[model samples]
Target: MVGVKANTAAKFRLYPTADQAERLVSWSHTCRAVWNIALAQRVWAYGSAQRKTLQAGEQCSELTLARKEHVWLRDLPAQCAQQVLRQLDAAYENFWNPEHPARSPQYKRKSHQQGVTFPGQAVQIRKVSRRMAHVRLPKLGWVRFRLSRPIEGTVRNATIKRDGLGWHVAFGVHRPEPVDRHVNAGPAAGVDVGIACSVFVSTENEGRQRPDTLTAGEKQRLRGLERRMARQLTFAKKHNGGKYSKRLRRTIAQIAVLKARQARRRADWNHKLTDDLAKSHGIVAVEDLKVSNMLRSAKGTVAQPGTNVKQKAGLNRSIADQGWFEIRRQLGYKTRRYGGELVAVAPHGTSQTCARCGTRDSENRQGCGRLFACVHCGHTEHADRNAAINILDRALSTAGRAGCAASGRGTAQSTRSPHGQGSLAGSRMREPSSNVTAA
Candidate 1:
């Protein structure tokens, strides 16, 4: 535990017995209660004259006193409760830090609290069979879970959580990195993420690779479920929310199942695509997209009502269905793991700029047209394929600072802007920098 470094989490489904399930539920409740109470203490203290902030170590001592008063709290593990306080302390730190994206820590509700984490000493995993294993917990002993795969290293900690599907356990085991060096034998490629297609890849071996999006049947099914759930909720509310409660639950569950399936398919597609890219490409260039910003709700305020809100909403769904950010994230890690480079260039004029003539005119980009016919040069190609080629060329034009930095070259590096702007003033730096739009 002292030397182990966290590499990744290995999650497995947990099939708890009825008695154990009740205990796990109780533990989740206790953790949530502790978090809310601790948050309240710090918040109230903030308004006081002294304005002293609470600390986890101090709270750990207070927890002992509280357990003496409320015997029920003692039933759960001490480390679990302590971890909750530590989590709160970390949250407060984040709130005070200027660089952190932390907001005010709010009280955790039972439905929202994921679960509790057990420290290294408290988590003991033992293999029961080739495909099954048992983990010992604080209150519930020997809960059986699928083996799924071998735990690579010593289990440092375990997080118990429940999702729409079911309960599961995630082990934070630290596996050491291998010392062998990797040499890239594959070619460089550029990827353009879009709504119509999940991603259009421009690689040397294959002129262009475009993966299919969610099937029409799947989209139709999701829409049907959404409508059915909405109708059931309306009926339940009209009936004072008691008589149609069962029917409402059934409808909600169906929607959850469909959403979960959709998520799984996207994740599978993303992983496979990334794996191939990482394995075959030494340099992967992608447009740095702010997905959440792009997907912001189109419903504007009262004064200026949004235009084409419904159309925008549908487009947002398509953008989300592509999982643009997820693909980028996976490529980042996978490229590093495979000793490759991940270059994220600015996404400003990739579509409008022709790959042939480098034309930046709007006429070069016909609206809703898959074909890109450059009026200046008369170069015609698939719009996505054209964009992908531009992205790759943009990434390769600068000798790629990402690769230089990863290979430990920290110095003045020039970057070419995607908009065909002149080179930015070069400066000596310790880390790699890419052409990203300034906020």
Candidate 2:
């Protein structure tokens, strides 16, 4: 089968020597400074009488001159500093685009995570042993890294980032072969994501909950650490002129470590879940949820204070914990990789509408219960499962209209369909009621 080229990234843990690590940190700071300086220049240019917009090429020319004048900037790799300018330019371009969701570029703070990118020509990788590799970078040669997996294709670029855990390097590679050459021939499923249940599949008639990333003991320790950090912040503000003490900095690092652990665990679980869904189903359907809008704060203006502030806060936390957007993002690429299709449908009244009867009434859902009893047809089923079924039905109808087929390679793949008034009119599927309370 003829294959298409695809771009992917591979990440590994880096083990730098003490001096190299210090230099890496200093270079990150330099990059951050470059970003801030470029942003300030752009702002000044825009506000000036000429209102001239600075381009990356113009900034690079200026950066070359500045490097000649300053020894510190000269020590930093020229490519790395130029990359920062390019990133700032891209940020501004995204902000200017009406369809893009990115906000305007902002000044980088000292606390922000640090990273630097090197073009393909500036980085050279060499395999040292079965489990070790070495990458030669500009100004910093022969940094050893754990080869968790073999690099699959030609390296296009590499980015090094520092987090609470440690320094890591990610290589962007271009593969000659496509992720999936043949279309998938498998079953279809609709997934309904919720706070109580992480995923509910329409075909399975069951809901699955994600395991907690942090254990009970870890949660307690995290809470205690947060409280201690708050106390330290109070002391620093009142007595130390808002300067962080060594102990306070240590506490912050500890907190970052725990948070990173949780994030890694969550990402692992999401990857597993998405992989399974993509491999088993030729067509997977899900609600097109705007997670940012769902997570908006409910603290209204002082003139009209919001009600149930604490309840809203808790709901926001639950929504964020589920990582709804992350799931959608992973499913998007994974489905394509597995020769499957991912469909997103409007989620207007999936919960209230009956999957069997097409009845839409708010009274069908009584309180915050798992059971969904349809008033029109007297059909009762799990709320999430019913919603999932509705989502699948809508996706199928949308695909049918778009001339999609069961083989998964179709025009409807990754398409979003608006909710139709009569879309759920005849979606009648029967399943055993024994698992109505599975969640």
Candidate 3:
């Protein structure tokens, strides 16, 4: 592997005093205001008769004069406010890039949670005990936080944000990539992600489901809260001029709490699963899925009405809950960190192609059943497992014989490196021995 810089973040729970918390919230609001004002200025400049364009440098110069004139702008940290302008610059850059998917920058709503970022030089960290630490910010001095883990690299910057849970701080750190780790000699595995089973492994011959993060009662309560919120929103739109009442705000907070819990659980599971896979496998192959495309709205135009809209909606929800994109994201960095390789193969017809016989027929996957019976070759296997094997074979074939040898699965037949290597003569499929353990 080539030498490269490794950048990561260390996040910790912040414990701020009541006054400090209030101040932090005010700073967030100031940041949001700066962003909105700068965006508005850019829009106006673009629409002017001269068609003048405003960049961050010119806007920042204007901000400097405004800060001297306005006490409110002067109260916020100058660096923090500058960071907001930089972020706005980035947003515009992304929007202008043809390859970037971001849309034009928009005004920030009061409900949106915008945070403040300070340069590393302005922030200082001091460890007071084994479990607690203190960080000094521009305005907030020596705020305490839980020392969940040791900071492993030089701090590049720190961001302070408020979520449904509470205020938190994240430090961006930079470190040199490790150069002395042992070469990966573990077996290679292919993974299939699906709605029914969160993941299936070709080498392990098993499928695993994500354990329910929320209890049945909690889920029921969440549904009730959602329905109530909908009713409240309708009433507010009709009678209250579309303004959210205090009760509506409280309900929104409650929903945020539940959703945050679910997100944390899913993130935790993904981290553990990816860590294990990275450490155990020399090569990990998964389908390169375009989740956004898969989750596209099923509601067609009135003139061209779609079929099975309800069924597609349910499927979309299931796929989203599985967090396939998150899993792939974690695998990408974890593999690099663990001295392993991550391969993403095209997903076309993986489920329909038989891993054993190389047959491509829709009938191979019959009627949503778990079993996959190849119509042409009379081979049978778990549908997900079959797809996983195909994914691995595609990866191995693409990587050529070098990858096959590294995985310790190298054989004369496997070295041929055909497109469907899983169906190569002498290739054997392992039988399912046990269920995959949940993370």
Candidate 4:
């Protein structure tokens, strides 16, 4: 049956007491230990069977590790222990499959994760009359869930994770809704993505720019973390016994936290931007940018040795914080839900080329210019707005152009530049020894 699938997230605001936090951490540790034990048992079974294959099969099923055998193992819940075995089996199966040759099976370790989910076990949800959850874990008696929204479908599994800021529980549910249709308004809209102004919309809200100040702050924090990490690394190198300083370890953990914060901020903005676009516009047009390639080019360009780095670092940070991929992902689903469609147009020359006359020449455009003074048609506009206009025009010219992967082709795609902003002509860049694909 044709159906729609959506993940309805319900985040609960909870202030778990220190005691509750400790209990949760202990449970997490127990889960990790159980998983490692199960993995070890699987390895032993494979060896006893005189087979080099790591895939969990009949041999692994025959080898059962009891809780009483190990004190740490006994601390884990029964369902958690079972899930560990299942995960080991699944991991082994994946490693054995030749089609996925990149991933190989490896020994489980503590740092892998401390969470477990059992598909077979029935997930219990207890809402007490006065208390939040009637029955909690052995130590955490009654945890509260300030559930902002209702959960739909049959929740198949639940996972508790220690996020950077706090603890969170994610529920996986099975939902079957009607298929969402993709509809577009009579008019088309264009978007310009950049570091200065994260997003510049050119339609309902003309000339409106969404700046990423939060992203900038996160990067500033990241720069501080990097300095601390570097100093710690230096200290470790000088230390004997092949030992690392405790401060170094703590710095790494801090860096991880900063990364998580940055990720959260990016995710938040992407959701907001996608929601706005889906609700306001029928068709959304955006430039196709190769951010991964761009970042690779900027790695060795950082000049400074410490917190005081090159200016390009800020640009690099901004690009990452923009969360273009996350925006695309959210838009892909949200557009269908609200009867809208997203289109990616060729980014080449969209910024430099005149949207009014369709004339493209880099020579006429000065170094890193933001004004489009077209010699052929005398068209002038803000650089981003001009690009946006061309994006909208490109969307209108080609049907199904917004979501087509091949939209990266065409005369709008660029060379040398990441965003394809400096194409000399309305022609694809000539590769001396490579074929130019569609934009």
**What lDDT score is found at residue 134 in candidate 4?**
22
Q: Which stretches of candidate 2 lie over 4 Å from their true place?
A: 1-6, 177-180, 410-439
> Regarding lDDT, does 1 or 4 come out ahead?
1
- List TM-scores for all candidates, in order: 0.80, 0.89, 0.85, 0.65
lDDT of 2 by residue, 1-439 (tens): 1121115677899999999999999999999999999999999999999999998889999999999999889989998898788778767876886644457999999998988877665777888788888888899988989989888765656788888899999876655546557677777788999988899998886798999999999999999999999999999999999999999999999999999899889989998999999899888899988787888888899999998888999999999999898788778767767787888899999999999989899999999999999989999999999999999999988876234444565543332112111011111112111210111
Residues 224-260, model 1: lDDT tens digits = 8789878877776787753557777776667666666
Q: Clashing pairs in model 1?
A: none
For each candidate, the alpha-carbon lDDT, in order, equals 0.71, 0.81, 0.77, 0.57
Error of 3 at 343 (Å): 1.2
RMSD of each: 9.4, 10.7, 10.7, 12.7
The 10-residue segment of model 1 with minimum total lDDT is: 420-429
Cα-lDDT of candidate 2 = 0.81
Ranking by TM-score: 2, 3, 1, 4
Cα lDDT tens digits, model 4, 1-439, are 1122113433344446788777667777776765565566666766785755444333334334556576665665655555555556655655665432225446556555445443312344554433243213333455555454555554444556675667766555444545544344434568787755566677634454555434667778889889988877777777644366777777777877776676676677777887887677766777766666555433453473344345567766667767665565566556555665666767888877787778888754666666667888777777777778888888767745454332322232222222211111111111112111111
Q: Which candidate has the highest lDDT of all?
A: 2
* 7: Cα error in model 2, Å: 2.1
Model 3 agreement with the true structure over 211-252: per-residue lDDT tens digits: 997989879989998998999999999999999999998998
Highest-TM-score candidate? 2
